[model samples]
Target: MASHIVQNPSAGCIVKFMQGNEPQIAWVMEEQKGKLRLFLPNRRETTLSPSRILPWAGPSYPATQSKDAVVELLNRHRERRERLASEVAPMELWEMAQGEMERAPAEWFAELGYTSPDADAVAACGRALLQCKTHFRFQPPEFEIYDAATVESRRQAEEAARVREAMVCGGADWFRRLWEARIGRHPAPDASTAPEEPVRGRLEKMLRARMRDPETVEDEALWKQVTKGLPDDPHLALLLAMTWGLVPEHYNFWLDRADYESGTAWEEPLESETQELIRAVEEGGSLPPAEDTVFISIDSATTRDIDDAFCIASAADGGWDVEVALACPAWFWNFDSALGKAVFHRATSIYLPEGNCHMMPEALGEGAFSLFEGQARPALVVGAHVAPDGTLGEGSFRFSTIKVAKNLNYPDCEAALDGVENAASPFVESLRLAAAMSDRRLASRVEHGAVIIERPEIDFELEGEGADITVKLRPYPAAPRAQLLVAELMVVANAVLAEWAVKNDVPLLFRTQDVAVPREYAGVWKSAPDIARVVRILVAASLDVVPRPHAGMGLSAYSPVTSPLRRFTDLVNEAQLLSVLTRGSVRWSREELSDMLMHLSIRLEAAGQVQRFRPRYWKYLYIQQQARAHGDECCWKAEVAEENDMWVSVSLPEVQLGLRGKRSLFGEKVFPGQELHVRLGKVNPLRNEAVILDVREC
Candidate 1:
């Protein structure tokens, strides 16, 4: 039949077909039904179906000819078709074909350009259309002219693909160079030699974004493609960022990992709110009358955000009249505003050996809202009477403008209280009275089954920058006297406020430790091993809306309302207390407070992790340096806290670090309260790992 004859190509007919994207010219050697055996121009033979061949097939030759003759014929035709294809412009043909017809065979397109076209001309037109996929799309027997919109979109996609290829080719070597420079393997590349414009910017942006959030990076595929040859480093993104100068050396990856923004840049959005609060402070803010009493604030020498201060005097009934003035940002804080939400998101200030990240903007936390000395600032004052026997009476809460008379540091205050030479100050009498009150309270707390463990206070400092960073630990001065006085007074104030909240039927967050403790575990513990033994039986304090006994503090309930500038929960509690005192009702309902606490608790837990890990990282670094300098002679005093068949948990009281080792490492006779000298082994700060190499009884 005629249809059967058309279904197969005869032998020696030159056919054009696509192997992949490239068009190949081949000679038909033999035919069986719809299948054709073809010989290509490169002397290769293949079996293909008629459907695989392009519609433009031409000029027949005799199959009985030798292989050399067939190859010569195929090459000659291919050269002619290529020359013709170069002469044809796909866009010109597309412009002429569009709106005239939806699609047509290659002969139709070729004839439009040439009035009398041959098979070679049609085949050339087909080849040109195949290469220009943007304007023309081939579908079997015809070329489809794309619409203007689709053509433009395809043009952009093609350009993007070309640029992406260039970036990957150029950026890989560039990044590896930077990483090499960061490790001091070689000098960094100059700016002139870096990848040009959009490529450089694109790479830097992707690297920084990946460093900040690796888990949710959208360009993970591209990242993998570009960083194919780099080392498999978990902190590779961070290291590359550091090398690229996108971040500094020793950058706190934890902040980025936690999605916490670390600088004052986040404060920009709250400028207007900060200015309003400053104006309020400068113009004597809208609040009740100023309190006449002058309060004294004590903090570390570098502290700037002073949130709590107190003044003591003799009461009418011969008891001590203690007035605690807490920084009152809650008075003007609008929890629904942008500024409020930002503070809530920050949750708490992070104090590291390097620096502090304040929860509130410094303009408010360290300026207008801070309890700076001699400045008239708004405050929530807690007035209560402390009896001679360290008993707290009913408390009175009020919001009023107040001024701090003095600001003192712990070292000077300690020396003053100890009557050391050249440390005399104006508040000697007040200091003595405060110390007496703290002594009485400590005794009372011990009598009430409190578990008090006093461990060493250690401070860490960074000496140099970058790779030469040296961490040094020192004993914290003034912890024995001045720090104790401030700690006790703040506790008294918080307990008083919490008790008042319970009596007034207001919903407030209280820190409760409701577990029972043995009476023998009540006294103060000072030794490293003794403190370790006592700490095992004490329950951790927790926050809740309902009041409950705090076994650790020996109080019925405790609420932290002092450091509003540093802690979000303190600000919240102050808001609750200030609301009832000023507006005569609670600002948040019980359900709302509960829901808020749930989110705040999660944030607090994350913040606690940062605080907990950062110091230990430095401590491990310090230990590693020591071991390298001293070898096996490097020893640290650790007190065993608990032991079982499988493990022995120990505490390094000097560094405030807890560690555990395998039972085999400690031998068979290990017990709690045993102090030992240990040599650390194989410390890797990045992995957060350190092993006890050897141990001996101290």
Candidate 2:
């Protein structure tokens, strides 16, 4: 290193010094043995070695000047320094912008040593400032520009700051005024005369802002300050509950979150298409003749998409001949049409607590293609021969038109089977045959090591709408005689179809679960914990183009060919089957099936999440409501389903409520299958959380 000694240096002299490799200008302030204290162009003071100093070559100024002239020169120099500082590095421009000095006028460039007539130099400096603005937040007025993202960020920050200020100084009224000002409106001079609409609008905006940027409004004190005096309003209270992270009064948010579009009049099948299809069916245009069989459908009373119906009769070879007729939506559905594509994206109908979203257009699903009583509809019929020993024999499928004799619901069928008053008049013989078939199928399934989980299903019905909503929970009646009949016959039909497809080497979607389940599992479970344990061990079923055994259903091969009106996969399968029957081969190849499944999986997963979560939300809401009605200290009888070191999962059988409780309350001895009485508390449906306040052995 060279000796850093400055000799004979005076104050107020412009000098150049080496800072790293580049030379920087400074004014000498004081001197020491080997170093000098100097002031940089930007007026920042620093100490440097004298060896780095050199006399400035271009300019010189006397140590003393007249006061007025000196002042003028200093101002000019300061302006030059500021411009230089801004140009020196990108960080300096950022600092200037952050300090609220975003622009510099053309006159400032002239003051910074550029002549007024040097248009190119002035333009160059402006260009430089414009380039810096790209990297910083500042811009010269001459080269001003705006970016949408940057503008949005600035607006959000400013709005957040304003909200904070309003919250700190004024309560709800002041914030409402500020919001009105932002939207270019003036508040009423008298508070009594203020329009309710504007107040509600302001409340909604604030709630949305709080939800969108929670970090800004996370302070509890600030929330209390801003929300003061607004809770009394019913609408504001509801919004506040949502903003405070509680479940909203209704489940409408799910529709928005899931992007579910409701059925509209315009969404119905085109009038021309409907009329043409109806005329075609009437004239028997390119369709198979009607079948001579008494067909009946079993479903919920509210069901509109009655897709599958069946009839059982004695065969010629001393066995049962079972005929199943599936509504033929595929005959009219155009696979390349926009409606078909929409149905593919939806994948399946969504059944909610309040209503359902159909997979097919209403006009077609419930009217044109529906297998209603006395209506002649086109269908795909599958005929299976059942041996006396409950073994399925030869099966064949065909396309035909069918007339359903009646559409019976499960309850009505059950009542008919039990020989109740008016119900016994219809479908009594069909119910008897269905019961015998179900019993045989159940025995077969049990012999094949299929585990039947008999957990009681709960039906949650919402009466009324919005804030006046009330949820009714009741047992859905698991495996009712009528339900069992429909389920067993549908399974047999699907299995026969799956086997036929595989034997013929046709590409079709097959539901598979190749995992090995316990071979001894059988029968309706008496304990919830036992059923839960068995369920935990079973692998989830998946769908593919290849045939594989479904261990849960106790089938060697299975595919869901029923419910074409409710599921797109079924519709696709129905279409393939129709093509095979009419054109002598399936329409889709393995690659095409795989491609369809790739998109189907994403949509199906999303729909499944909505189905799984939204129902639980409503169920928990019902539980909370019950607790509130009966008082928090009310106890419920629960059976322990599972337990760990810290928590115990309990099943409330009566209410069909499954929840967990801290193990500390019941002690370490708690185990599955143990019955206990527990009090419910801290029930929050929005968060899906609840705790057992107290517990004891029942």
Candidate 3:
């Protein structure tokens, strides 16, 4: 997390805090630690120690200025939300919501002018009530509160010091990872080829070898050539794995490839997590120690800062297997730890064009806790013995330390179709089969649809010095075991949570992106027929939930379970499941659950934007550098890959970019089918926006 914020451009001239914007404060009427505090934008450089705040800022000032201004903003917001919320119930149900917002520091409420805050409050409650106990609140303090001693210059000086000291990138190990991120070819270079291969004929020959066999070949020449080709960065492969699922963990397992390529692969501690796993295996015992509690597990995207394992079993009924997995973050860090929350906020792993930043540390991500191959690492398996048709068969959910026997990737699992050594074992094969069954279960729900988008990715060659990377699909992009295997397991587990909630009448987050209706989602799918079709298609995929099709994935009720590293929804999904299934937590009232869902849905959307736009801005920068010769107004031809009422996926192979539309560009209305010039214009440095202009006028 970058601690030093550049400036507060959005800062209003109200009150101040220690020479900065104490623009926002979080005050739950009950507990402070339970929730987070966002002080204007984000408290990036500020070491915000939450002080018990009593109504200090005084009554509302309206987040903006004029009564008319407040009325305009609040009224407009209310109108939009009321239309959406009308489907649920009468507006009278959310009385508690008004109270919660009122308690949010008088200044915060006042910022919105409180002209008719009750209405805004109602809308907020309705949205939250609808989604995953989630919703976004507009909190603008009427007047800023400040201690007012320090100057901006002094604050800047202090912030610089904090950033320099806090950033571990100041160290060599971290620096090396960042360096390779700029210019490294992902998957390690050594893993790309053998120990020796002529540089000239390398690309063509390796392409051929890959076609012959994607698995590791004991070729020394290829091994050496890989080291020569790849940059020494541990985080590069980690980054690729998180974003595109292109680089598999097979490329850098154990320490051989990691040490060879990252320059410190062999530097495992004798008393480290690796040693503990080996020791446990030697002793014929569970991973680490039965009583140690914290397990250090690692994957390509995650490092050794995890303390639990999870797997699946069948449910009690003669149906699909129920999934049971252990999450030890509760034992490792608290909600208040700045670092911990940052990781939690990320919700899932994000693979960057160059490197990856994991949600947790390396020790926890890949340690004694991780269910290692041929070793029974301690795990909290949520197993479901699902039937071939995705019905919940007999299942069990428990914590245990069991040997995983065979660790396999997608290709390996696929190869198991043929007789191959180390093919996906029966245990994995069952999970895959179970996932397929769950898909059928999901498919049975006719109202929702799942939108599957193949957003191509990139591998940058950044080694300290930034090299421009052309983002594209992996040359031979194929499905892998880990991808869908985890997906099905999570869906089933999420279903379990939903089932438990309903059985107990626990109110919980039920997520749904607003459908493409005429008034709502008008940004896309303008035509009534097109909008209705999109909604029908999406609603069909959003299964097992009350809402109809997602109108996106084509799944009536499609939810993501794979990456908890980058998405908050995944974290909430786990939390809900654990609370309901494991601890037998009480369900919130439907109203409460609805509120939570609104926030979760909104945050998930926000987090996705943050994850997407940040690196994408950087990628766009590199793209311009890569295709600088194409000039600005060439015929950047594109074929309509996918489209809805709101936007269309337009692919232009020339500059290698996809243009997303504010509204749908479906059917014959787009390029590739016709000649259209796309002007790759200016980019906003802060928003990270790459503006695309249609230049038929050219």
Candidate 4:
């Protein structure tokens, strides 16, 4: 037994004390009142009370031990601690399972020199290892661990189970659950009313089989399988189809209403007779060539289907003799044939950011019928004499063949016309004559109620594919002089042909726009919004057998006789003109023409939607990509074009994006013509959505 003596310890006095049931040796450093400062053999110092210290009994080393002897004692203790640590290092149950141990018990831990207090404590550790066996594989009964191969096998089994469960419950049922959750309604409790197991199973199987190979929802067998015995709900069918990957997220449902193909492929290959005719045209026939005329075509650099080219020479009667050569595809085209019917179905070429879907076959549009330079192609040549004041004399129209002198893009023509010195440019005189013609035409149109909107055109070109895709936006240079020249020439050619058609009593399709405008509202409006308002007030232009005034162009009559490569209406008109010149009769009567236009109108409306919406889709995608690349802090300078009580319509002229913003962001001061700085957010290309986040005065 140890005697407990409560006495104050002096400085440098060695003492023994109990530290958590283990005895420790400490030397007293100082004593003050009720506290003693003690330094342990491990060099840790602490303040304690007198009651905590015990009198020393075994050795008086604190007074007689040399510094070397004390250090040697510490070194021996450290060696013992390190040996113990090596023997009892905490083993991860997983590491233990990887070794020779098949089954471990509490005694096994003791045999391995584990440092737990008792058998029960070791057993508690074994229980913890058992719980870890789910992620780690362990033998049962006394659970010890297993190797990596066993763990991987368990993981694969779990994944297979999960996949099976998902197959049974995922496709349509998952979509149905989401729909129910979104609408805040639970499924009906009647199991009998629910879709039968076999039917649901079949649907799921079909969906899973096509998981990697998706097809359009229009596939008859797939559609039948998806909708069999399901409720007659279009929304539910659409949701299931979308969820199962049968349709794209941004798919246009309106596209399904029409039967015409929208890709680059034709509905059917050209008939053998049509092919022969095309070959014949390409083989070069004997035809009268125009005399001493220089025909130059002004178009885009990428223009391939060259339709019309022009020449301007001084007439003997104090006027400019204009010769407009229209590419005569109608000479080979059979209006009553199947190829003609196919063209009528398409109605017009669809232009998108990706490219164009040509109305005529490429073999004709870009080959034989295309007015390539140095190729003497058949043409409907229209001759007119323009006076110095730009008044047209009597015009003459006939069929002839002419070689195009030059094919000049807008830039080249504009540069040459601006007197920017190019070597031997042949179209300068013609360009000058074109400018005079445009001035005269503009003055005449302004005298009427023609409104021209000169909005900058934004051209979108997509490069690469997938994650590497980049959208390049360039402003299509509006070369006013060059554009006006082409516009005036096309209009004059159409006017000349329309006059001849009327005088010859030929029943041709005429573009008529008869709107009841205010008698006082007769002036040329150039601004976009102003022109848009005028367009809204006017009736939509339409095709008719009867000749009528085109109020928008301020013409007594108008018809699109150019660009037969692109527009089916122009091709139809060309065929009519050709028949009148050759056979002295029209190809189609007024009734037959009206019947064709009715069908063409429906198809045209659908094609128009594709043309209008697809570009807008890509434009929205561009904005989305821009927002993601530049982040939220980027602000675009926008002008308010129109405003209402709740929204302000703003136009981003740089990107040609017109979007609306909340009126509250800009306060009541935001009105039309107000320029503002705006930030975009929540741009979703798949949904074709964008939102203006904030707006402030510039």
Candidate 5:
């Protein structure tokens, strides 16, 4: 059928055929039906079909001609055709024939370039068209011309392909050399060994981007091609980025993973809002009324965003009237504005060993909205009368401008409670009253099935920056004196405010823990073993628009409206409460608030991961440093929380770290509440792994 379709060449006729990418000249020595016996240029004989012949064929030769003569003729023809192909400018020919016709034979193109073109001229035209793929597409008998737009696009793509090929050949090897140089596997490479200009810059950018977010990398196919021969390591991009000096050692990739922006750069777009807030704070007198409550705030010494404060006074019925003043950015914050959206994306402030990532701009959170001592600031103040029996009476919520009388740190307050003169001495009597009320409240909550764990805070101090950084972990007071007062009063304010919301039927994001706990699990727990035992059976709190009982707090309902400057949920709740107090209606309906919370839940989960893991990352780094400095001689105190045949879970109360090891390392009688000292081995901070080398019972 192919013989019927294709015309067979006569014997001894020189023809052109394709051998891979190059064209070859061959003489037909014999013909049989569709088959032809041909002699190649190298004096080799082969049989081929007539359909295999290229479009162009040459003049015939004598069958009895010498082999040398035929070979010489073939070489001469090959040289002539190649030279003609070189002389034909593909672009010039494309310009000449582009608008002339949609498609044309090679002979026609040769005729357009020459008067009465020969077979060599036609074949050269075909060869040139095949080589110039951007302007023309070859299809056997004819070549198709591309339009101007398509030709330009294809030309650019062809150029990019060439560059990519060049990068893969040279850039990959260059990166390998740099990586080897970084690890001391090879000598450092010189500047001359780097890839040229655009490739070097582009490669560095790509590596950085991949290191930031590896899963969503652009040009992933090209990345695979370029990194084909590199080690199949998950942290390859990070390693390469470090080697290229794009990032420093121990870079925070978790921030990149969550797409959480660091620093005040995110506050640039809200400059106008920030300035407006500052002006509002400076102007003063825009609130509902001014309160003469002389509230005092108790927080860590490093705290700048003072959101909540409280003051106590004796009521007529021998009860303490407690008033709480919370920083109110809700009065000026526009929830529909860009700043609000950014704040919502952050969800909550993250306190890490490195620094605090505030939810709101510092201009507003720390300066304007914070309840700074002696400064008149807008506040959402809640007042409730706590009876001598610790029963809370009717509460009131109002928007007021208040000034904090003192800003006391925990240690100074504790010393003041012990009758040591300090800045907190003026409030010593009031602190005693608050502590007495805290004791009664703790007794009342425990009677109602509350489980309170008073865990000491671990202060992480960093001495340096980057790779040479050192960390020191110091445990704050285990049985806190002043912290208990602040915690109980804050919990009372939230519970009363939540109760008020229920009566008013206003929607707030209430924290609900609707689980039943055994009455035996109710008292305060201070030891690590005691805290861990009670915590194992407890469920985490959940958020909802409807009011429900919070089992852990032992309250009828609880809503977080204390930290408006640090948490988005508290700001929203404050806004709702302010609206109900002013206009007698809620700002957001139940359904609308629920829908908004769905989006916030995702961001909160991401923020929680960063908050929960980033500090542990630093703690692991500290442990590794300690292990290296003292080897097996360094020991850490651990309390066994759980034990099984396979593994033992222990809690290190000093650093607030938890670890698990094989049961065999803890001897035959490892049980809960058992104290031991462990030596860490095989510590890898990046992977969050620290193995226990040896353990000894204390």
Candidate 6:
């Protein structure tokens, strides 16, 4: 009895017809050459033979003869999957099935290439083969046997893929909409549902109080008191802001807006400078006289448009002579033209994901009035020379039409310095000497006190297969070698400009950066860098040499003149330079320049919003993959890469494993990061989610 009950080594089967139950597919596994054999469950079993299993039963099959009319059918089918699944199989099962099919190959003549079936025909045949074990199927007489099933399966698979892609696409759209709606730039579905309330509290009063004061023109009396007949311009304001000086955005907002409006006044407050601006540009377009003086660097190897140039030569009494020239374009695109109005509405150029947004059309921006090519253009030049050690010497401003050799980007010049050739220009040599002198001067100012910070500049990759954004840090070797050279001239020029303004009492923009206040970051202060350190951060950004520290660079004083291609304030600085040198006057009022400072500050802040979102989302996806690929088998270890008020950063040691291309799931699994794990845990690649199970301190 024990021997008989030993659970027959195999389920020896006999076919029986059942009344209700669906036909059970059982493979007829029999002992053959001491190994198990599997026969097709779809056909009937008969006399056993070494060959001639499935006969050429299909009408489409080749005309071949076989010894047996009957074939073996599987007794108890192990399992069955979807037709498409079986046909496509997984990538791993090709050898076994193909091996079987190759031997005594199917008794059918597969069609030749000259007359080919369409994709649908191929898919239908493939499905039929999976369902009918012998790769033979009963097709409607209306269709070819192979063509029908092959075509059908393919259609089904395609439809499934289409659905999957739609699901993914729809889901992404939903989330993006949700995020945008929350930010309030646009209203969402529920946005308008709120009941309209009666005019209630004084909303305007509060809003007005919060908004910065507007003005038409800068206060002339106040400005002249400060500038002293020199120019008060945009560069000065930007530098002042950099040095922690406060400038409100609303101050300049209304002034720019006034140009497009008619003599009819909008409710917005604007300074007196705004009136000057509207009158100046209300004509066809702003264009200065071409025959006028131009700024040039005639020796650059590969550039067009000489926007600005500087000159440094030995002065009498063993002093140095220096001069800085800047391009001007506001004279062209006046307030009346549609193009100019569009630029005014945009407020300034926009840097975005797809491409750049220029405030002014290229017709003016890179053309006509542009400091492009060998064409002599108008310019406001500021020339100054310090002693051999950078002590402020003789300085003056003038109008000039200088020529430029060629254009060079930052990298081009850096390369030249590294011996890449053609980057250096004879015209730029004098500036280098001036830069050395300026560096020495600024060094001394730092000794007095100024702030300096080293931040990793950021950039991004717009397109790649992944959903998340990634950025590669540009190497420092890319920093332009001409930086200090040009900077010295600009700074001295700016210093002279500012000093002239103060002495002559003119209104102009002044840049400033504030020291970090302890109360603002008190939450973080409670844990990390105490109040003292925070103060250090502020001080490090504020040491000014000529009282205009622009301390963020740890300089007593500094000014920006490079890359006017993108900055509006720099152009404004050029405007101030023009007023001072050419007219011996000041144009924009302190209120107007101050107002622009406010607008730019806001613009800078808004740009940051777009940048931060992409990277954070990408990081989330990467972490999901990290958790999925590694299980809770061991407590994972990682190093601290960053830490802040809310979270600590970590870096894991190397381990070899596939991260399963983003958001793909394998067997059922849990997500990672569910818990604050010092340990290993579950990961879900499908949804880019993670759950931390256990954590071990690293």
Q: What are the RMSD figures for all models against the true structure?
A: 4.1, 10.2, 28.1, 21.6, 3.7, 26.0
- Candidate with the larger lDDT of 2 and 4: 2
Runs in model 6 deviating more than 4 A are 1-307, 314-320, 333-341, 344-354, 393-395, 418-420, 423-435, 456-460, 464-477, 514-536, 539-549, 553-565, 580-585, 592-604, 607-698
Clash totals, every prediction: 0, 0, 167, 1, 0, 126
Model 2 per-residue lDDT tens digits across residues 1-698: 01222234555554455566444556666666778777665557788776555422113356564445444554564456445545544334334443354344433433354334132233334334434434333322232333446646766776667656644554456445534442347632343333354334454555554443444444656656765644333234334434333434563444444555655543664556655666766676656778778999989888898999999976666557798899888877777776777778778888887778777667777777889988888898988987656677656988888899998888878888888855435678767887887778777877776777776778878887665777789888543888888988898888898888888888889989887877656555658788778878788888888899888878888878888888888889999988988898779998999998998877777777677777877877887878878895678889999988888899989777688877899887887888889988887665567788999777
lDDT of 3 by residue, 452-528 (tens): 33333343443333222344332223343344445555555555544544455555444455455332322223222
Residue pairs that clash (backbone atoms under 3 angstroms), model 1: none
TM-score of each: 0.87, 0.70, 0.44, 0.65, 0.91, 0.43
TM-score ranking from best to worst? 5, 1, 2, 4, 3, 6
Cand. 1 TM to true fold: 0.87
Q: Write the per-residue lDDT of candidate 1 for residues 72-170, one digit (tens) a residue.
A: 998898999899999999999889878888888788888878777776788888899999998888898778888889899999998778768867888
Q: Which prediction has the highest lDDT against the true structure?
A: 5
> Which candidate should be chosen as best, given TM-score against the real structure?
5
Stretches of model 2 off by over 4 angstroms after superposition: 1-248, 252-260, 263-286, 315-319, 477-479, 643-647, 667-672
Q: After superposition, how far is residue 83 of candidate 6 from its true place, in Å?
A: 56
lDDT of each: 0.83, 0.69, 0.39, 0.66, 0.84, 0.39
Clashing pairs in 5: none
- Higher TM-score: candidate 2 or 5? 5
TM-score of model 4 relative to the true fold? 0.65
Residue pairs of candidate 2 with colliding backbone atoms: none
Which digits, one per residue and each the tens of the lDDT, describe model 4 over residues 1-698? 11221134566455445577543555566677778776665667888877755432122234445544554554454344334434443344456545666555433543344443332233333334433534343333245455667767876777655554543444345555535533458642333333455545555455433332344343445444334445544345444545434454444433444454655456356556557757777676544455445688888889888999998876676557787888887777776677777887877777777777777777777777888888878888878877766665666878877888888888777888888766316668878878777777776765666655566788888888643567778899767888888888888888777777777778778898876566445566644355445656788788888898887777777777887878888888888877777787878898988887887778888788777776777777788777778887778888887777888888787777678878888897766777888998887653456899998778
Where is model 4 poorest over a 10-residue stretch in terms of lDDT?
1-10
Clashing pairs in 4: 97-145
